[model samples]
Target chain A: LAKTTQPISMDSYEGQEVNITCSHNNIATNDYITWYQQFPSQGPRFIIQGYKTKVTNEVASLFIPADRKSSTLSLPRVSLSDTAVYYCLVAHGAGGFKTIFGAGTRLFVKA
Target chain B: DVKVTQSSRYLVKRTGEKVFLECVQDMDHENMFWYRQDPGLGLRLIYFSYDVKMKEKGDIPEGYSVSREKKERFSLILESASTNQTSMYLCASILAGEDSNEQYFGPGTRLTVT
Candidate 1:
């Protein structure tokens, strides 16, 4: 299992882009970088995932360098509703059962 | 959309009480998981099931058990609840063999033991 490290918290103004990066120095070859977002008192929802290069979705974008040791989750034009805890994880396909979620980056989008 | 539903949003129990947290998914997913979330621990997996009657222990499985009697329902059991066990419990499910590692999650159950 690959351990992930992320910033404890971050602050961003509304309409601004927010980028949170995670470090996983021991990522395996079969590991994929995945991100999830959680609101207060709610379960987390998948944001974006990527193996390498860049992957974009409706909610967020995931960027992985060639080394795959670190990944960044980019939120474009963040809103107040984007205030939540974002988790970064490394796991194989459908093998999220073994994934470990460390203390995620708590993003506070202020208006 | 895949919907995962838990039996309760909030639950209160005594220290020695037996607790059962039920989770059901509308999608017929083969993999179901139980996790507990804490202030600083993030989300810790407790147990998971790949198919009915087949289960595996996760990172934190002490004082917890699970049952998967059907394809869409998974249950977490606490034989003897403790105050230390008070936390938000989350349930998730995903289809086996899918290329994506996306797991649909339930709203979560806040369990408090006195």
Candidate 2:
């Protein structure tokens, strides 16, 4: 499993876009970048995933450069409800492989 | 939607008591995992099962055990509950075949050992 690095916390205002970046310099070819959002007292939910380039979903967009060393999770027009810890993980697949969640980026969305 | 259901949302147990945590998934997924979350530690894997009756220890499996008798159900057992073992436990399941992008998580169970 590849280790990921992210900021401990970030502050964003409502209606503003927020981007959280994760770095995994030694990402393997088979690995994919996945982001999860976790609210207080709730299990982490899947936000977006990408293998390369860009992948967009209803909630967020993932941008992975060609180097695959790092990726960014972009949340457009954020709201106060989006205040939560965002986690980035690198995995080959979600089988029996254990996911290592680092100290996630805590996003505080203020109105 | 894939739903992973844990038997309990909250539990309280005394020291040295036997505790059982049950997890069931309705999507017929081949993989199920158990993790415990604590402050400053994030989430730590306790155990995982890839197939029926097959189990694997995860990052922090000491003082814990798991049983997978069927494909849809996975159980985490604590032979002797300790106060240090108090934490929030989460259960998750993922599809077995290709394109297993994300794992679905269940509403966690907060266990309190006294």
Candidate 3:
């Protein structure tokens, strides 16, 4: 499993684009980066995932450079409801595996 | 869409009591996992099962056990509940193979042991 580091907290205003970056200096070739969003008292929801380059989805976009050591999650036109804790995780791609989550980046979206 | 349902949204138990957390997934995913979440500590895997009757211990397996009698159901058991066990428990399931990057999670059970 690769270790991931993320900002403890971030603040963004409504209608602004927010990007959260995660660093996995020792990420493995077989590992993949995934992100999840969790509202208070709710389970984390899958946001987006990428191995390299950029992958975009309806809710967010994941950017992974060729180095694959780091990745960024971009959320466009944020709203107050977008406020939540975001987790960046790196783990093996197949079978049953588990990875530890870091102190996720707490994004506080304000009006 | 994958639907993972837990038996309870909230539970209260007394110390030394046995506790069981049930999780069922409709997608028929082969892999099921149990995790506990705390305030400062992020999600910690308690146990995971690859297929029916086959289980693996995760990072924190002490004081916890799991049983996967069928492909769709996985249960987490606490032999004797304690106050320190009061936390949110989450269940997740994923399909087999590399593209199984997305793990669908249930609503989570908030267990309170007094």
**Candidates arranged by lDDT, highest first:** 1, 3, 2
lDDT of 3 by residue, A34-57 (tens): 999999988898898888899998
lDDT of 2 by residue, A1-111 (tens): 788999989999999999999999978888888899999988899888888999998899999999999999999999999999998988875352777777789999998
Clashes of each: 0, 0, 0
DockQ metric for all predictions: 0.77, 0.67, 0.70
Instruction: In candidate 1, list every pair of residues with a backbone clash.
Output: none
Which segments of model 3 are wrong by more than 4 Å?
none
lDDT digits (tens) for residues B1-114 of candidate 1: 679999999999999999999999999999999999999889999999999999999999999999999999999999999999999999999888876888889999999999
RMSD of 3: 1.2
Q: Per-prediction fnat values?
A: 0.70, 0.62, 0.69
Instruction: Give, for candidate 3 chain A, the lowest lDDT window spanning 10 residues.
Output: A94-103
- Candidate order by decreasing DockQ: 1, 3, 2
Show where candidate 1 strays beyond 4 Å. none
DockQ of 1: 0.77
DockQ class, candidate 2: medium
Candidate 1 per-residue lDDT, tens place, A9-108, comes to 9999999999999999999988878899999999999888899999998888888999999999999999999999999998865556587888899999
lDDT of 3: 0.91
